[model samples]
Target: MAIIKAVNSKSSIGTAINYVSKKEKTEEKLISGIDCNPITAIDEMKATKELYDKKDGRQYSHFIQSFNPKDTLSPEKAHKIGKEFIRNNDKFKGHEILLTTHKDKKHIHNHFIINSVNYETGRKFHTTKYEYQAMKDKSNELSKDHGLTVPEKTKEKGKITSFNQNKYRVMERHFKGTARSYVIDTALAVKKAQGKSTSREDFIKEMKDQGYSTNWTDTRKHVTFINNETGKRVRLANLEKTFNDSNFTKGGLTDEFEQTLGRRERSRGTKSIDSRNKGVKRAYEELHQGTDGQGLNQPPSSLKRDSGDRRGKQKGTRANDFDIGRAKEHIRKSASENARSLGELSKPDARTRKIEQEKARELERANRRELERRIERNKSRNRENTR
Candidate 1:
């Protein structure tokens, strides 16, 4: 099996060219070039790039085609396959390419450094997702043609990110032998609770139900969890990297709470949007029709998801704060305008006081109306379910 990867080299063109074609790693016999000389590949590529005036940014593209160690393919065979793959690929036909097969490692890997500027038309070689995936497919097809068996492809793990990697790796080292690990146990419990709970308060209650005490408040920078039975206390940050998800870090839980609650703080918690919209529309119609903002008893009817679905389910939508705030502001302005249109407000006295007061009154009535509407709707559903 041969796996292809594109390398985004940060070093300058010359440095990258030297590293890939280093004499100790690969020999002149195993190296070849396309539209450029392998011995002077770097100069040829630089000259091509300089001619096109595209030397300001990227100079060349580096691609690595590595074969499986178990394949036991000879350097000559791998080099032949590498040249064939590149020549057959339409994306690199017009570009200057340097192919080197390195035998220093356990597996033989072929390196291809293609000039950025095309030799034929001076056009810069650009890579897209489609082109990259096609290269992989072509390379794999050739590998299979040579009677090599490709292993099943698996999801690639994330590369080591620059941020706090060393610090997190330190914690990961401490978490070795986690079979009876206390901190690991707490993190598992925290993730379990976060999966089910929507609000910070709900999360806290869920943790309590699991017999874990959390100092996880919005104001604090770090949360510490204490196992009730084991009496083991550990800061959330001290846990392994896998357990330390962004949702349970710092004000993450509170941020999620604020988003989930959305415009439903007055109703204690938020429900599915499908039901919320219905309640809001019903309340608006009732307020305008006859209730005069009085008989509105419908808050949004919440459809509780099955508890079984909540367990082990981590995926959820995060509410957009800007849209939610805009929606809330729209309601207040709309209520104020409606009151004014009905001639209920006097510009002299009500301009400063009564408009705000009327907006509040209408909103309160709408909320109450929704609450009552949901209760009646639930009773009806329950009666049918019993039947």
Candidate 2:
């Protein structure tokens, strides 16, 4: 696993550059620079800093990328990975960077020295905790591409997945400061709550007890949640990934609730074609299975007969206004035109078609000849002008 660390160094930039770019510890070939020449990087950096008029307390920012010794990695690959680590990070976009790969130590590592003042914008480099995590995330990405070792993430506070000493690697980047990040975070917390609640009511109650106002109903299009204290509302449908194809277009909270209960009561829920035993399964089926326990897959039956045809359009709504006689007349006229067109296609004239094709070919040939003549005239005119 490649590990990355960043430190704001108060020491001299020249001293760090010399220590990193030493030929005995690492070759000049391995030492590279971004937006500047490695051999005269210090001079170039000083010029940029002076251009920005940054007479400074902090000289440069330092970063270290060290690799796991257990993995067999080459120097070139390691250097390439280190370069990518800088290039891929958006924070280092306009900064001049000095990168050197050291092979002298048992554990191969790369040193990154960056100019504090950006060349183009003259902006000083600054980093926060979030920015450091972003760098670590980038390092993990580059390391994975090269099949290098990557360190497992440490557990964060407030998340409850670290029980039983289990290593849990879930969730992903909440991109672009969008609402989807909060929705996914809510899903993780809700999933943890679901693990303890056995029934649908119990699950909703648990979420309420946890201070999340449950807005999930079987028919509601969005399984929304409201934070009681903060008064923040988020829709699970906002994530746009329901992950279920059935009728539960919302978060499928109801389905999840019932499924968990079913898994728990498998002994009493399984019927096994034994009609003699009336178990909890029957009660569950009656509750979720259709209206009046008709069957699990049966659709809800209406007490009154439907007024419309098989299309479900109400009887007096549109059927009464539709003109069947006008429709029949329209169909008859369309058939007549179609038959006339088919009859026209049956009669063919070969000589007329051949004459049209010949006329097209002759016109194309004349255009090509005229183009060639124009090219020859231009060449002759150029030769005369040159002489």
Candidate 3:
């Protein structure tokens, strides 16, 4: 699992670049590198960017891509994924990017310093929610391709803290052993309360009596419980699936417990009857048998009636009927139309293609002029040497 975050820093571009491209965190300057001009380094990149965009906004956007600690990913692999993630984004393309992997923490994470302006076009890269989501999607895709665990995708808006930050926060609060242990203790308390309560309100009251406050209001989706002692709160759904509201309703637990007891009693009774009437051919007949008298192998009459009704309805339906000839003609027409549409969409616009071609011609002509100038300079130098 990879967690990607874009932090728009208020500091200068040089400061942000120096922070991410530090040599100490990157194994004494072994793998820390940049994707900008080979001739110029971070300073020159920053200078060029400042010369182009003199806006009073964020200097650079810092992106942190962290992988799960449990994943056996080396620093090189993580850095490669981070670089690929930056390159894949259309906004980050043609811009100077410096990245380094930090091994200071338990997990391997990459810090990227992206220049706000594109060196070629001088257009600023605007960060948006769509861009963040695309980065996350690309990270997960790369993680899966590398046989790593994919994190659960959440639709919740706003900034999400990293896994380590949340863990440290919970620990800093001085909660019992861990959050999981607290959840287990709370679940046991809820179970004990369910045994004595006859209604949902009574169950909640029982829990409150045991120093746990619940937030099972109509507005809240999950049943959240707060421990009065530790002042820690956790949603019941996060503890376990069975602790959810659907399964932990009033009288629901008691009814399930009773049904389990009834099944045990029936099994014991069946064994006793079998032991006493071993000589009889239909020893199980005395039990409540179905039409086949084979115990529970056959379903009850009501279930059989429901199944028959469903089968009858399915047999009478004509939704599956179709004309093969007409269907073939329709499929051919649809296929032809889709192919034509795809071809038209795949082709570049004529006007844009013409402009790109003209730009390429201008670049070639400029390169020839520069080559001729260099040759003239060299010839003049040779004549001066002969003199």
Where does candidate 3 stray beyond 4 Å? 28-34, 37-40, 53-55, 154-387
For model 2 the TM-score comes to: 0.42
CA displacement after TM-score superposition, residue 58 of candidate 3 (Å): 1.5
Candidate 3: 10-residue stretch with minimal lDDT: 153-162
lDDT, residue 19, model 3: 68
Off by over 4 Å in 1: 154-387
**For residues 1-387, what per-residue lDDT tens digits would candidate 2 score against the true structure?**
677755434578898899788888899778888766676678767766665568585788888888888879877778989999988998998787889998998888899999888876879987653676688789888888889766653344323221111222233233223224444455555766666676667877888878888876768756777878778787665432321111122323444565667777785556553543556677545444332334444333532233324567543322123344556887999999999977765667655676789999898677656644543454355345435
**Alpha-carbon shift of residue 316 in model 1 (angstroms):** 69
- For every candidate structure, what is the RMSD over all alpha carbons to the true structure, in angstroms? 24.2, 23.4, 22.3
* Residue-by-residue lDDT tens digits, candidate 3, 273-314: 987778464544333343332343434784566466874654
TM-score of every candidate: 0.42, 0.42, 0.41
Q: How far is 195's C-alpha from truth in model 1 (Å)?
A: 24
Q: Give the C-alpha lDDT of model 3.
A: 0.62
Question: Per-residue alpha-carbon lDDT of model 1 for 167-212, expressed as tens digits?
Answer: 4454445445433545545666776776566676788888899998
Say which candidate scores most in lDDT. Answer: 1
* Poorest stretch of ten by lDDT in candidate 2: 160-169
